[model samples]
Target: MEFRAKTVAESRVETVHIIRPTDLNDAGRLFGGVLMQWIDEVAALVAKRHSQMNVTTASVDNLRFLQGAFQRDVIVIIGRVTHVGNTSMEVKVETYVEHTNGKRDLINRAFLTEIGLGDDNRPAILPRLILETEEDRKEWERAEMRRNLRAKQRKEGFHFYGE
Candidate 1:
């Protein structure tokens, strides 16, 4: 299958949000579910930008909450495509708290597997990911390992990935 190539920065996405009272849970901290929704959107957008097609979140793995966010905190979410297989791509989404001094602390991290949707809602062919920098290369390698682990969990049932 013919596939185009896209750089990691080509589809990179960054979004900022302010944690409001509504975003908090009964404990008065930012709700985990709300943050997950935000990151999920970022992942989908990254995949859509890279593939130039509609995308769906097939799986969310390695979701980690490192810290808690409070109301009135500025939240910054960044998403980037780490690796691409035939029809799917792994997107790493990071959530951080931006301080007044411009410092950012990582609050959460997740890797989402997004699959492009073609005509008739079938899995779509996607462009390849070009690893331009050492960081990008390392992220690709980590994603490969994650995919392999996931494949092992599924007993290698997938045909287009983790082989």
Candidate 2:
């Protein structure tokens, strides 16, 4: 089947949440695990939007926690497709703390690789990504570099998880 190409804007996702006590860690800030889960969801939403297919996360790269968020803080998350491969797409997710003044402070950033899944639960072809702006183009180029680095690492027998 010929998949339709989708623009980065088409798959962009934004979500907001209030940090709760249950979502906090020992230091009284948002838990890292919870934040990671939220990031994963955002990335998955972007990939699914771009692919129009069920998707699963294949890998996560360059996850950087820049700051901590506390309880009662309004958190904002934005995810967008940076690039697409034959079967997978790269999604960049950014988490921010929104202030009452409508300003946002970035707290975390992560990139995820998600693969489209066919009805049979195997990898499926994904639609190509249309970069609309210079920023999008730069993101695509950066994604390409990350992809190539991952490939080289894999080729050199580097696996964080046991094969």
Candidate 3:
């Protein structure tokens, strides 16, 4: 049986600010950690919608800082679940800077895999994923690759910074 799949944009919960003061480095740039925090929050929301259970970050893959966000600029975090696994969902989040003139630029892109936890504090199964569009197909393929990579790394006994 096939279950319905939800898009990343559909599960976005909120848009937080990329305040100038958050740039602790004083390099006149928004900090990388700040952007990650925003992405985590948004990805959590997407995971909750898909799993209907408490979720926690399993791993963050391919978080590339493509551009920088200015102090007063607004970073819009858009996120959605691209694939649902037996006990985890992969969420793709894109952050963009909105200029005063209404121009938008893609600042960063990342993928997060979060596992749904049951009341027993163990991973739980989620609804099956359904791919609807070409973009979704591409994302699903990418997600599969990421999953395989993570598994291989785990078997090799490597410790990552964040999981």
Candidate 3 Cα outliers beyond 4 Å, as residue runs? 1-18, 156-163
Candidate 2, superposed: residue stretches over 4 Å from native: 160-163
**Rank list by lDDT:** 1, 2, 3
TM-score, predicted candidate 2 vs. hidden true structure: 0.96
User: After TM-score superposition, what is the CA distance of residue 66 in candidate 1 from its true location, in Å?
Assistant: 0.6
lDDT of 3 by residue, 1-163 (tens): 2335555455556575756784645687888887898899999988888777789998888899997777678878888788777888889898888888978899899999899888888988777666767987988888889888888997898768754
lDDT of 1: 0.94
- State the weakest 10-residue window (summed lDDT) of model 2: 154-163
- TM agreement with the true structure for every prediction: 0.93, 0.96, 0.85
Query: What are the Cα lDDT values of the candidates?
Result: 0.94, 0.93, 0.80
Model 2 C-alpha lDDT versus the unseen true structure: 0.93
Candidate 3: give its CA RMSD in angstroms. Answer: 3.0
Q: How does candidate 3 fare on TM-score?
A: 0.85
Candidate 1 has what TM-score? 0.93
Cα misplacement distance, residue 142 of candidate 2 (Å) = 0.4
Instruction: Give residue 91's error in model 3 in angstroms.
Output: 0.8
**Model 1 spans > 4 angstroms off:** 1-3, 156-163
Worst 10 residues of 1 by lDDT: 154-163
